[model samples]
Target: MLPQHDRRNSREVFIGNVPMGGNNPVRLQTMTKTDTRDVQATLKQCRQALDAGADYIRISVPDVASVKAFEKIKNKLAGDGYRSPLIADIHYRHDLAIMMAGIADKLRINPANFGWPPESKKKQAKKSGKSEIPPGLLAETLAPLAEACKKHGTAIRLGGNAGSVEHTNTLTKTRSAEFLVNQAVKYLDILEELGFYDLVVSLKNSNPAETTEATRLMHQRMQQTGQHYPLHIGVTESGLGVSGRVSSALGIIPLLREGIADTIRVSLTEEPEKEIHFAQKLLDVCRQNGDNVFEATCRDNMLYIISRTSDPDTLIAEAVQGFLTLPERNAIQHITIEAPGMANQQVVKETAAQIMQQADIKEVGTRFISCPACARTSTDMEKLCRLFRKELADYPGIHIAIMGCMVNGPGEMAGADYGVIATSNDKVNVYAEGVCIKRNICGKEAISLIREILIEDDSGR
Candidate 1:
């Protein structure tokens, strides 16, 4: 449960059967980049993400064919015992939303981009009856989507944007707040008429003022209607790399801190997984108390806030079975050393550098010892050393000294609570406090033995 000082409240709503909101952990979602019409590839990607800890999956059902794909994906996921909610991104066609909402857990409807023309333009579109969408007919068309989704037990996402309404492209920045609110006003009435209340609202824009101002107005109007709804907030299409993270963050932080957004997706052109990572960070930043702003790790060129940036390395060290940086250095937190002949010493070195540079720390994870890999390490020394380092990836807190042979391995690792050494091609030694407590046969088996030691030390197992 969140403490009183935290701004966001717990509002648990089940996606498929997975509960999100209110005292539960934040749910992570990712959209399948696959073409939705391809059933085999799309579901495969969805399941892959599901296996990778994605809590929910969203797919773009742009056309009728996409709905067919959705059905196929839904069935497969259900068969696999996957309960994460599936969200449908509907644009330019409410019919797609109507057709697929039965299988989908959520239907996203962007009012700004409702699939219709303005009253005047819509009349022309009707007269022509070609492929153009009209504005005034937006509500009439989407009414079916809302109705179908509700009857089928799917929730709705009524999306609003500050830059421009999504579907019609008719409303510009000059549009009044009253006009925007009126658009949603009509939408809510239609939704209410359909007897649908399982809905969330999203009011996002590149411009924060318009986003927030319109949100405030619409929220007040919803109050007038005596109905409460969840809101998903984001700053859409805000550049890329660090710039995107900052702009979206600045725009989103205000709304979240005020307890406005119930769900968030920081839209980015980067990989879909990258989007999920940043979304977690922003949510964390908003939930944090006092002035704990920099409590994030700057990893993979993305920033993630968990508490204080200062504590990230230490926590990672504990979580991963690697050593935390032993010394503090102002803005920097930890450091680890790597040397050769230790084949995976590179792993320790690279991880430490990334932990400091990307994870926003001052130092490293483990120390590496190298007598240098000569012409003779080809058989088992290199293989055993590499496996040893990789297996300890989860032991986050303790320092392990990787040394050259058993000569320096015994003494150089004196301060380390744990160490691994290659005794020869067929033998290895595990040392604790200068004593070889575990004897090893070569190959990957040595790594497994070392991991058992870490588990016992860390988990008291």
Candidate 2:
């Protein structure tokens, strides 16, 4: 288990020599508002942001010409003895990403635009469903980009912005959160499959409330799936002046309290330097208010163990005992066991339960149980688990189980306080405190039923 700042234990990612997420201080990042093709102006803005304590400087790379400008900017910055990590913000031109792979320390790819063919053909794709590229094809298209980043040791940000893309017709506050989560998860899966794990995830919306909710949902999903990608959060098109600052702060601060954000940008419609100052202020508030925010939520005894071995369960149990022996053990907060193999949700849950019985470790508010998902999984187990976590984020003293398929699903879920078991034909059976309360509920209706049950349980109705 690595050291955590608040409740989150994000995987650490490096941009140039600077580390973001996990144990590192929440970083402040700002983008150069100047045209990236204007090397001198871009250089000036980057320098301004750098001087203002911007941890990472982003420049929009729209074409090959911009790639050349980026090279000049990178060279000039390094020649002047400034090693600030430079990010190439590529919206529709992933070719630029491949071109500047080694040139930039990080590449920002918007999920909404990267898959669509070059800017000119984007209109053609937008006319139909071509814009929504299939996951496998999307992954194939991004493989070269991933390879280039891997070759250069650069990180990728799967940037999801509400302003850049239209929402599905079914979009609501809740559905919008799901939409963002699905976009992020789909892109992240593609990146992971391509063996590019040096990544950050962000879900940005112009609306402050939606921005906050989407980021929270993304965090919960990543946690439930055991993906430790760092998050870069902000409110997109956050306008200017007091309103922009207020909206951005409103969106970012709450997540910061929950230890959900890793790096943040204020995205003010003002000077790039202003963004740096505003972001720093937001981060300061997050730090100042952290103690009060996390006083009740922080669990000092929880430990998340990460290892690559055949037997993660035994290793996790041993870690708990070893963690207890340390003099500074009391300082530990939460632990997440991340072993490459044999680290499924059932194993993690059973191990945690066994450890709790042996140790006096207090349980957290919500407990999630889900299958790791295989060919036999009849339902989207990962999505269900994440949605449960999101809905149950504030609910305490509830154990929720999400299982796919019937093999070990029943037995595994029987241990949970409440369970949603996926049977054949895409139907779910809901259990309450280990008792089957409803059977043969299908589709989204199952989720609604589970929510009602939990709400009733929480309200003691």
User: Quick one: best TM-score, which candidate?
Assistant: 2
**Candidate 1: deviation at residue 412, Å?**
61
Assess each prediction's global lDDT (C-alpha) against the native: 0.55, 0.67
lDDT tens readout by residue for model 2, 311-393: 43233423333333345544555555554556465555544443342222445445453443332344655456556666664
Q: Residue 265 deviation, candidate 2, in Å? A: 0.1
Task: Give candidate 1's whole-model lDDT.
Answer: 0.55
Q: Which candidate should be chosen as best, given lDDT against the real structure?
A: 2
lDDT of 2: 0.67
> Tens-digit lDDT track for model 1 on 420-458?
666665666777656677776664565676667766766
Off by over 4 Å in 1: 1-14, 19-27, 39-41, 44-53, 115-140, 166-178, 289-461
TM-score per candidate, in order? 0.56, 0.59
The TM-score of predicted model 1 comes to 0.56
